[model samples]
Target: MNVLHLDTSALGTYSISRQLTAAIVGQLQRDGVASSVSYRDLAAEPLPHWLPNPDPASDNALRDEAVLQQFVDADIVVLGAPMYNFTITTQLKSWLDRVLVAGRTFRYGPNGPEGLAGGKRVIIASSRGGKYSGGPAAAMDFQEPYLRTVLGFIGITDIEFVRAEGVAMGDEAKQAALQAAHATIGELALRKAA
Candidate 1:
């Protein structure tokens, strides 16, 4: 399988989402599920903010098309998405803008909007500073829900999130979250292998 692995964390080695994504991709590689992997560190080399229109032959336009093509060619996509201010990073959003193009990934149909791209799996390594999965903070969580909405809009219904929440709560909480996420990754690999 072709795996597109994207990391959008500015924290580098200190990012929990980055660690989870690396471990998840590594597991996929070791389990022989991934035939090839394409890695893009968006934090390190971020795409320019999306514009309404650009010259067709411009370098940025060409790069955007390439990014969209990569997404189309991949069988699976792995995203290291850390919640910033209760949402995704700017870098990840920029990448999304390129792929969610009209007549490419989706189009307006007689009924409504229809997705042209389908049948791909998306795995998100979601990290948050505090617990947002439940309790009062759940309403404030715009990260995972936003991701689900946009990806689903493009017809990707097969999505999974290996979440490491409450990482900044304390050392113990961070460790526990990581342990749980790792356990989930193991289970994911086993399921894929099956």
Candidate 2:
């Protein structure tokens, strides 16, 4: 299987989401599930913020199409999504803008909008500073829900989140969250093997 691994964290080595995504991809490789892996560090080489361009042959349009083709060709996508101010990073959003194209990833049909890109699995390594999965902070969580909505809009229903939340709460909480995320990755590998 072809795996497209994308890291959008500006934290680099200190990023929890980056660590989780690396572990997840490693697990997939060890389980013999990934035949090839394509890695992209969005933080290091960010895509430009999209704008309307009438020229299809423009450099920006070409770059956008290339990014979209990568998404289209992948069998599985492993994304490192670090929550920033309760939402995804600007780098990731730029990447999404390239892929969520009209008649390419989705289209307007008789019954409304229809997603053309389907059958690929998306694994998101979601890292948050505080607990947002439940309780009072759940309402403030725009990260995971926004990701699900956009990805689902593109017909990717098979999505899984390996979350490592509350990392900034304390050292103990960070360790616990990492451990849990690692365990989830292992479980996913076992299930894929089965």
Candidate 3:
């Protein structure tokens, strides 16, 4: 399986989202699938926001075409995110802005809008400071829902979310959330994830 992992949490090694993504990736490998990794560590080597090149005649299309090709070939995609200001971090959004190019991930047909990529699954590992798992606040969660909408616009409809929330509350809350995330990983984040 070709796995494209986009780890955007600025906390880097200390990030809970990164840890969960690692554990999930480890689980997949342990389950015996030969996985190829494409890692994008936003803090280390961030994906460019994809502004037009300096030369007036230089086309953005050529530059973005190369990156979109990478998206088309991956079988599974993993995104590691940390909540910021009740939403996703800027790093994650920056990467999305690069890959979700028009005519690459999606295009407008004569009939209607059409997506190009297919047959790939997306896994999002998120870490939040407080509780937004359920209730009215859940609807306010901009991270997962935004990701779902954008990726789905490119025809990536199969998505699974594993969150480690309330980690900042205390040791007890952190442990409980981590355990729950791990359990979800065990149940769903397998080699051949369904």
Candidate 4:
């Protein structure tokens, strides 16, 4: 199977999302679920955000096509999505803009919208500085919700998330969150392989 791994954290080695995504990818490789893997670090090499008025034949189209091809070829997609300002990072958004193409990932049918890119599994490693899963902050969480909406729009319904929240609370909280995420990855990655 082909796996596409995308890292969008600017924190590099200090990024919890990156750490979790790495472990998940490693687990997939070790379990023999991923025969080939393609890695892309959005923060390190970001794609240009498509503006409202973009040149159709611009050089960015080539790059966008390549990114779209990667998404189309992968059976599994792993993303490192670190929360920034209670939402997803700009780097990840840019990558999403590249992949969500008309008539490719989705299309407008006579009745309504129809998604073309179905049957692919998506796993996200999400990291947040504070607790956003519940309480008042839950309403402010645009990270996972937005991702789910966009991915589902493209007909990708099989999605899983490994989350590490409350990392900025303290070292103890960070460790606990990381540990929990790791345990989740262990179970999820194995289950996915099966």
For each candidate, give its TM-score against the true structure. 0.98, 0.98, 0.88, 0.95
lDDT of 3 at 59: 60
- Kindly report the root-mean-square deviation of model 3 from the true structure over all alpha carbons: 2.6
How many clashes show up in model 2?
A: 0
Candidate 1 C-alpha lDDT tens digits along 1-194: 99999999999999989999999999999999999999999999999899865588988888888899999999999999999999999999999999999999999999999988889999999999999987999999999999999999999999999999999999999999999999999999989978
Instruction: Compute the lDDT for candidate 1.
Output: 0.94
> Candidate 2 — what's its lDDT?
0.94
Clashes of each: 0, 0, 0, 0
Selected candidate, larger TM-score, 2 vs 3: 2
In candidate 4, how many Å is residue 12 off?
Answer: 1.1
How would you encode candidate 2's per-residue C-alpha lDDT over 31-146 as one tens digit per residue?
88899999999999999888986898999888888889999999999999999999999999999989999999999999999999899999999999899987999999999999
lDDT of every predicted structure (CA atoms): 0.94, 0.94, 0.80, 0.92
Q: Which residue pairs in candidate 4 have backbone atoms (N, alpha carbon, C) closer than 3 angstroms, thus clashing?
A: none
lDDT of 3 by residue, 10-51 (tens): 886679999998887787777755368777677787666767
Deviation of model 3 at 170, angstroms: 1.3
List clashing residue pairs in candidate 1: none
lDDT, residue 25, candidate 4 = 95
